[model samples]
Target: FPRRRRRQAQAPLSPAMATPRRVPTILFASSVAAEQDETFVHSLGLNGLLELIAADASFAPYEQTLFAESALQYSRRMQTAEQNGKLDRRVEGFLNLLSAHFLSQAAQKALEYLLRHFRVHRHNSASLLRCILPYHGTRAFVRVAQLLRGSEQRGAWLRDGAGRLTAPPPRELVVGRAAKDTELLGQLTYLGAAHRVAASFSAVALLEIASRMRFTDAEAPLLRSLLEHAREGIASETAPDRRLVGMMLIT
Candidate 1:
């Protein structure tokens, strides 16, 4: 007779396997489906998110929502920074980065909007020039020059009581000084001395001053040079620092 065959024994399952699978299958299924639709899903890209954020009336009530979603996403990123616990310094740095980026964009948009919709009156134009005077970069100065040019184009005329004929006002009637302030140029020179500098605000300021002073095209090239230099410096810096400087330069 043949020797008795030995029976092989199977190993039992582990205790861990005995329990039901704990994943929330429904949640994962929804996420997968949502990802399939590009329009339905929110993108993290800067431009896309800015468009979404700007679409909301709150962020850009006066101007077109060119990058609303991106603005909203930036705000959310700020919140995330607040919640992050890994490094306290990282949180502050991230917050600064976000603030700088958004604020600069906002200021630019606001300036553009004003240029399109609002007429710069003598008083308001003076105030605007004051704001721009300390900051002497090309973009700002160019816009200022445009405003000043507009004023000059309109001429210094006043309507009569019957609104028939008008005559130019006396020199004292003008809102701002006729020429660019010497102090502003000095300040620009000082700021330009810095190695890592941005001049968005300076540009805006220069534009405003030029506009108020009614600077000729011949005079604007100097302001434009400052703006170009500032932009170059900003571009040369590290990514986060660039954002910070851009914001500071504009604001």
Candidate 2:
């Protein structure tokens, strides 16, 4: 076979003509998030916010961060309303939303964020606590108690040694607490702290928590361990309702 001369090798392409290389696109972080779908868009603005909050909004553990932002926004709106002298339905919605977040992973963060408003609208903040205290159970009680007493135990976030919160304390909140209600609030606060520390929460502390806020027509349970320690201070009132109970507590 006749040997054929090999074709000359092609020279490497220059950068200008280098097969039009694709440039890598880099995305920089921005304070504003990229826009999402219309559903998301519809979920913004005062009306949208109210629509979402009209119902009890609950978030999963993973969605707690988003929950925190939403709750904060609602709180700010309430502050604006309070300033304007218009305590409206929006306020109540915020409370309901806040209560739902308590059960989320952001419970601690939610409380911390809540305490942030203590200084601004203290009465409302207290109302906020009063509303959530009844419905959220032990987790809520322990946190509010810790904040009230300024618990700085391990894992207690947003807490300092002084117990000075970003906001105020836990009484005179819901229902326009009268001077009569002071003792009950104190008892509740202690009960909550005791629960946080099992050693601190003795049989005596348990009895205090059992102190009924509302008086029931039904007979009280006896045998305080076979009729020994009697549960006292059961007040006859009402059962309730907030980031703060939904504006139902608005004074």
Candidate 3:
């Protein structure tokens, strides 16, 4: 009876005063239990995350790792190795974590790691550039574009200090672009999975990559090709395809 009065006298919870918290979205088949995931992230840190990733072939670990925030020290191991612009094979697992619904600390860490080391090791990171765009959907403008821009800005410079400046051999070109580009954007728009969703997603990604490398002042083949796709997508029976075209127009 006395305890009941004391409990009732305590301050009521104020909606305005409560702290905001992250609401997790399902990214995999199922998520680990809340308490278990919290322990995984805060107790074991990033090493725990890597272990979970290695253990699960499915992307189930992302629920606990990508959306969960860890202290900065957990990332120390990645720091020393990446400091030298080299990454270990085991560390490459972070690539799977990049396909996030919204950019969280975990996603941001993976992004920064990739961009920071992209200049030194392009082949490893560049191979997956096309896949990154579709996962982010409209956020491709922010995440994928930022990644491409940073990689190009940091690595695309032609260095020739001795006055004998020569172009990098053809092998150095970004994926989907070439020394003398053949223009893959047109082909990519219609060449992927037959389903409208998959085709549209892949097409949008290729368009972004191709658009990035296009001549600054000169744009023709791509322009005409783009109009064709836009015309087709806008008139498609699929609502999602039409929506994709609308996003493409503004982007």
Candidate 4:
């Protein structure tokens, strides 16, 4: 009779009641919010944040906010160089990184922001020019030209950096060496926006660019305009080397 005592049957585990399920909960909302603080976000680095937003559509809402904050932080870094004489390598590297990451419309905006807020020295301006020239082409050049037109410091930078600026003229001109030839006659029509900047800016360096200006059927009007500006600039320019000026006037 003792052996026959019925054992209580164990309740079968149902799917809903399986092994006391862990009730999912946000342990601390404040802790989660703290993780998203600006300091914390900035620590992620500009590249990291941009990559996260770019890679995940879910993060799209934060794109503009992140970019604005990044720019503000960048502005603080640039302020010192703006007040001081030169931009050190650290600032230059940061600008280069910024240009490298944002190469689209965003890049154009950033470039404009730089022109507006910061004092662009020769090195920094060259870095920016290099960034914009290859990718954005004439439009970008025009924007830079507009910014550099009136500023004496920037104009000087352009003049000094003219040789370095030669890289971005059009493909045809580069291939033909038209701008490099003795007469400077071929590939005239293919001149990019950088040439326009040279024309707008009246500096001794303009002579270097002016000398390379070739007359062509397509670019005849442009040549005429440049000639007018060059002639005007030559009048005001002290110690203008006639040799360089003469070459510019030849065409």
Query: TM-score: which candidate is best?
Result: 4
Task: Supply the global lDDT for candidate 1.
Answer: 0.36
Pairs of colliding residues, candidate 3:
none
Instruction: State the lDDT at 139 in candidate 2.
Output: 42
In model 3, the runs with Cα more than 4 Å from the true position are 1-58, 61-102, 109-121, 124-218, 235-251
lDDT of all predictions: 0.36, 0.33, 0.41, 0.40
- The candidates, ranked best first by TM-score, are 4, 3, 2, 1
Question: For every model shown, what is its TM-score relative to the native structure?
Answer: 0.23, 0.28, 0.28, 0.30
> Which residue pairs come into collision in candidate 4?
none
Model 3: weakest 10-residue lDDT segment is 22-31
Candidate 3 C-alpha lDDT tens digits along 75-136 = 43456656433333423444533343224444443443333323213434332343343433
Reference-based lDDT, residue 155, model 2: 16
Model 1 alpha-carbon miss at residue 65, Å: 16
What is the TM-score of candidate 3? 0.28
Regions of candidate 2 where Cα sits further than 4 Å from its true position: 1-92, 106-108, 117-123, 135-140, 148-251
* lDDT string, candidate 1, 1-251, tens digits: 99998997977879654544322111123344333332222232233335524644333331233223443233323556443333233322222222223325434443332332222223134334334433323343333433432343322122235632223333232212223334334344333322233234333444444445434685575445445544654665544443444444444
Task: Compare the candidates by lDDT and give the number of the best one.
Answer: 3
